[model samples]
Target: MQKFSFNRRLVIIIVCLIVSFALMTVSVAVRNKRSTPPLIQQFGNDIVGLTDRIVALPANGLSGSVSSISELLNTYQENQQLKKQVGELAQTKVRDQTLAKENKQLKQQIKLNDSLTDYSAISAAVITRTPSSWQNQVVINKGSSAGVVKNMPVMSGSGLVGRVAEVNKTNSKVELITDNNDSANRFAVQITTKSGKTVNGVLSGFNANSGQITMNNITTKAKISKGDKVVTSGLGGVTPKGLYVGQVAKASGDDYGLSTKLYITPATDLSDLNIVTVAVTKQ
Candidate 1:
């Protein structure tokens, strides 16, 4: 029974092959005789074309999707690179601006040193500053070895900022004018009015809220006005004469009404101290 079944399959295959060859021969003969294909051949061609289109649909769609995904990934990578570059550029710009500002301040200090012909200038970089005592004091890299001594006036940027409070071998602590301590040193400041009258007073305290220095004990009611320039009076032989202190922001009657207390705005930013100059007056 198995042998008969195998023989039947072989016969069916042979018959199909013979029929296919006969059809190919007839198709070629028909094509030579007529411009149009035979109806049977046309039907077979239609079937093959339809099958090819149906098979290619998913393949074409998958190819398009793959291409789109590749393009999307590339674009995302480019965007990330661009963002990194932008961030780096922004950081560089900020650094450059900071450097430029520091350079300008250094130049101004150089000019200040040149103008102080009577006193020798000791330039020092601010080495230490605590947030709690930022306005109160700062430590400089210069010390007693470099002619930095206690009570020497320390100037930053353009004007007087502080005085040497403590001196060490390699460093010194400077007490700023904004120090509110009761034992803080007071500056003998004088303001020259528009009428050429010099009114002298002691810079006693600082108003932290208003960021202004307070001057009390006005010797005479000299009609102090805004924009009046204040300078060191050379009194007590501590701070030198002609050193710029600040400008008068406002003036009001003192507690006893016998004198006026002036609120003076500093010429430079007291909070942002960098390189400072210590005026070595005695030496």
Candidate 2:
């Protein structure tokens, strides 16, 4: 019976609080009609605004982070595409340069063919060079099957380079004029003078350090000059006539001081040999 009386008193107190809050809300609404909202209402609105900002803070931050991540991904994709394009451009440049170089080499071969009109030529590519200090030999792609025989003269774009030393079915080795061990490196060369007289000599030795060939056994009565053009004299049955050797650079006495020696700067640059032609005579 005592608990029932306490519960009845609690309910009466809650009813009285509810009636007091209703009277306060009615009074504020009537004052708002006369002018602006009262200070208490403005205070309530400010509190609601503060609560809304607090609620939205985490949502706004998350939105900004997502947007930044999306933009970063897009930038990365664009960067990758640009890198691929740059790689393709580099490859294209290399291809173009290679083609241009090949074209130039072909043109040179054509010019060489026209210059040697007297003899039939067999074009061959240099396979490899001998790995020696003298650089005295090179292997070519043509051999016995292509009519390339031992002692056959070989010429590059500039002039005579060497002669065939060994031959096989599909390849041959050319012994350059600078070879020290080759006994057959000697050539009968002649220089024509301004007066149409020819001076004969033997091209037998080469000085690697000076890049010059020594022409010894020059006849004492022969007249030659520094700028005279030296060529094969066609004395030996192997080499044909009129093949260019070099220009006379200097003249000095031989080691025995008995005969004259002419030093010649070779017409061909032996350092580089890409393509060559072998003179195939009718013999």
Candidate 3:
């Protein structure tokens, strides 16, 4: 009787398993993703209407949460595009600025060439500088090969900057008036102000190390005051006439002899120099 009862239980379990397997198979067959044509055809009109509604939804400036999500994604993509465009614009701006600087420099060279038509202009670049010496000096690109010889005066649009101190075939050294050995700065300079008072003074380096030059040696006969302009005297024929040197800051002279005092300001800001013109051949 026990063996018969066990066999009956086993039979019942087998029947349950078979039924579950059939149900599973049927469920899988019904839920298969292969064919949706029956449902689509049954609700074709509804599907079309829903599709129109989805297509008509505004992604921006909408009040619904779904619309908000869409707007955010759109805004994010737009921001990324703007950032890329801005980066490209920044690069273009840098290139334009560099080109502008070069153009300005070239225009200046042309102007210098136009101003001095008698002499030939050799375009030389500044290779080195020495500010520690009493006279300031700079090496240029042109040398004996370029026909740039020693003692050739270097001038800018403003006036004389210095002279050629050293030279080789492809290079030359320029001695600025601010150098210790340079004699152009040691002589007396004369300034005729707008008021017509002629002020006489010596121009020299302000310090042992600095390139700060000043107009000293004021004459006693001259009525000197602050803010007076100083210029070259054309005495030694080193630098040409009427080059701006400095402005008078203070004045001190003897009662009968020449007056001498310190000049407070420099006419030119030496630090801002980028381009300068040198006279290769001069009369």
What's the TM for model 1?
Answer: 0.57
Error in Å for residue 63 of model 2: 58
Candidate 1 weakest lDDT stretch, 10 residues: 111-120
Score each candidate by Cα lDDT: 0.78, 0.75, 0.58
TM-score for model 2?
0.57
If the candidates were sorted by their lDDT against the true structure, best first, what order would they fall in? 1, 2, 3
Output the lDDT of residue 202, model 2.
75
lDDT of 1 by residue, 1-283 (tens): 9999999999999999999999878855654454335455545544544455455556656866988898887897899889989999999999989996776688797874422224668998775564585347776777666887678788988799988876665566688998887656788878999889998878889989999999887859578899999998877776777788889999888899887888999988998876899987752
Provide TM-scores for the models.
0.57, 0.57, 0.45
Shift of residue 260 alpha carbon in model 3, Å? 1.9
Off by over 4 Å in 2: 1-118
lDDT tens string, model 3, 102-146?
Answer: 776887978743222234566666554555635466655566656
Steric collisions counted per model = 0, 0, 15
* lDDT top scorer: 1
